[model samples]
Target: MSSDIAQPTTATGHARQYGDRALQTLLSANRALLRAEQVNALYQEMCRIIVETGGYAMAWIGIARHDPGRSVDAVAHYGDRDGYLRDLRISWADVANGRGPTGTAIRTESVQINHDFECNPRMEPWRERARSHGYRSSLSIPLRDERAVFGALTLYAREPDAFDGAELELLNQLAEDLSHGVRHLRLRQEHAHNARLLRRSLFATIEALTVALEKKDPFTAGHQRRVSRLSARIARELGVSDFDIEGIRIAAQLHDVGMIQVPSELLVKTGPLTPDDYDLIRRHARAGFDILEPIDFPWPVAEMVHQHHERIDGGGYPRGLRGERILLGARIIAVADTAVAMNTAKPYRETPGPDATLQALRDGRGTAYDPAVVDACLHLLRDLREAA
Candidate 1:
């Protein structure tokens, strides 16, 4: 819980400094996994944790780069790195620089350790760089997920022969923890991306259907759009969760979509519809339900559309879904639909304005409309008026 996690003051002497450093490093990685939101930030913090908590002189992470060059790019570093991280062009190719622990770890997908960095033959090329930075012993451990190796974490110690069997074992666990954190972040990002693409496809599909309906009934060109907006507001006012609110909006957007099956002349008819014509007009609800049932929507969009015209008193048509039998989404859409329709001019009647619409809603609070939905609609009307 403490912010200063680098040093845990348990003992007074050299024992506390070196003996407990590995435990602190492991704890630091666990803390970073909780705090860091993404992979790049996680790696950067891991490098810092090794230097500050693990008692290492320096630490850096190198991710494998393909395509233009089969080389390693030092993505994260902590401690004294004037231009060393940028200048060190280590590669997986069988060459002088490639033989070092960093390149070797990446190529072999295994941990590479140099207990004597100054005397090792493979350390000859970058010996001066290592010596100037006070690094005498080094550890290059591959950071890997279950499937494959992604990168390497290179740690430098101040003393020679720093990494014995116990130290190596502890550091390997730290590497594994870092791999798990990175993999979790990548998976989260992939899932978010996929969800966004799926939503886009759903929106486009619904919009196409809405447009087709609007073209058939030119008088109601943007009626569906308005209903969708109102439904979303009403749902939000009712304290609906985000996912269910989207379903309400989508269903409301295509609420009258069954009208596309009716004759075009009947839709634009300015006179009162005959009994036979009214029956045909009402059939659109079932038609819309049939149309939407095949599409795999995450929400119950089809059922909401089918029941949107139903009354709480069981008098309204298309299934006469009464009381609790009607979906909550349909109830919210019902209030939104009536509010919008009453306030807007129709081919058969003049516009009643918002005040008249609210009056009608208040009069029919329970019998015709869901009382909860009506109250939410009333609050929204007041909010809209205040905003205006």
Candidate 2:
């Protein structure tokens, strides 16, 4: 087997060389931590950095598991060109395999160094494997979590007495940084999982509210769903982002939720209503806002519901929010709501054909509706007609 028997003439010369490499390893590892997004990716990068930057023959990370056998599993490794770890097994228990640098460092929660693997009795179990891989020295540093040591970062060197003094100190710091980075990434992943769960629960609650409104008003049975579809299409046509379009669609679905507070008879009345009836009908926007304002939604859902009826020129609604004052989602919902209502058969008004609806949108494009949203809606309607 090939061996690294060459040595520096002076101890000071070896220290200087090792110090420079260790400093580089520490710097590169710190930078990796800043950009690391996944634990496995970080582990792999650390092993690679240890070998490439510190000039080690091989490097690996082992996670200590409290399984039935108290095993230490090699999670990530680099530079084992001959696959020296293919049959390697280790444990933290006081066994033959566990007596090595890796297991002993983790077991004692400290650094374990073997300056000359050939002369070390602990290396007896895997001496031939180490020699075959050209590993004459090794260092293992325990990686800790908040509770206790969770893993070990082990580095193998081609030359004996490769790690010492300043070099070992810097490598220990690198291990500590890696442990903290792993813990942080896991916590972030868990928080994101919780956020997804919370979003699902919130959507469930919104669906139930929509169902209640549908039960109360027959006119609104399928109106919200249609408006939501058209609003999403219009938003997409206008180059709105997918995430914003999702919020727009959800707001459209619940835009008329305030109608739940309106009298059922008023909704179904075929006869001309007095000014008082019309005024009460207009209050639904404010009522919907009040219903949703207290809930913490990730999107501006409540404001969109409140301002869906508001005109761009300050001519409509519970609040006369003019021009840019209206939320973009609210503006999109307005056009969608208008298009759906005009084409649908209403008890008090005749159903306007697609041609008439298109004219009305053209007539009010910039005055009552956002010009861009109206254009998108017209484009969608024309496509639907042509497809039909």
Q: Pick the candidate with the highest TM-score.
A: 1
lDDT by residue for model 1 (49-94), tens: 9988887988999888774556888888998556657567888656
Local distance difference test, candidate 1: 0.82
List residue ranges in candidate 2 displaced over 4 A: 1-10, 268-277, 347-350, 384-388
Off by over 4 Å in 1: 1-19, 34-36, 382-388
Measured against the true structure, the TM-scores of the candidates, in listed sequence, are: 0.90, 0.89
How does candidate 2 fare on TM-score? 0.89
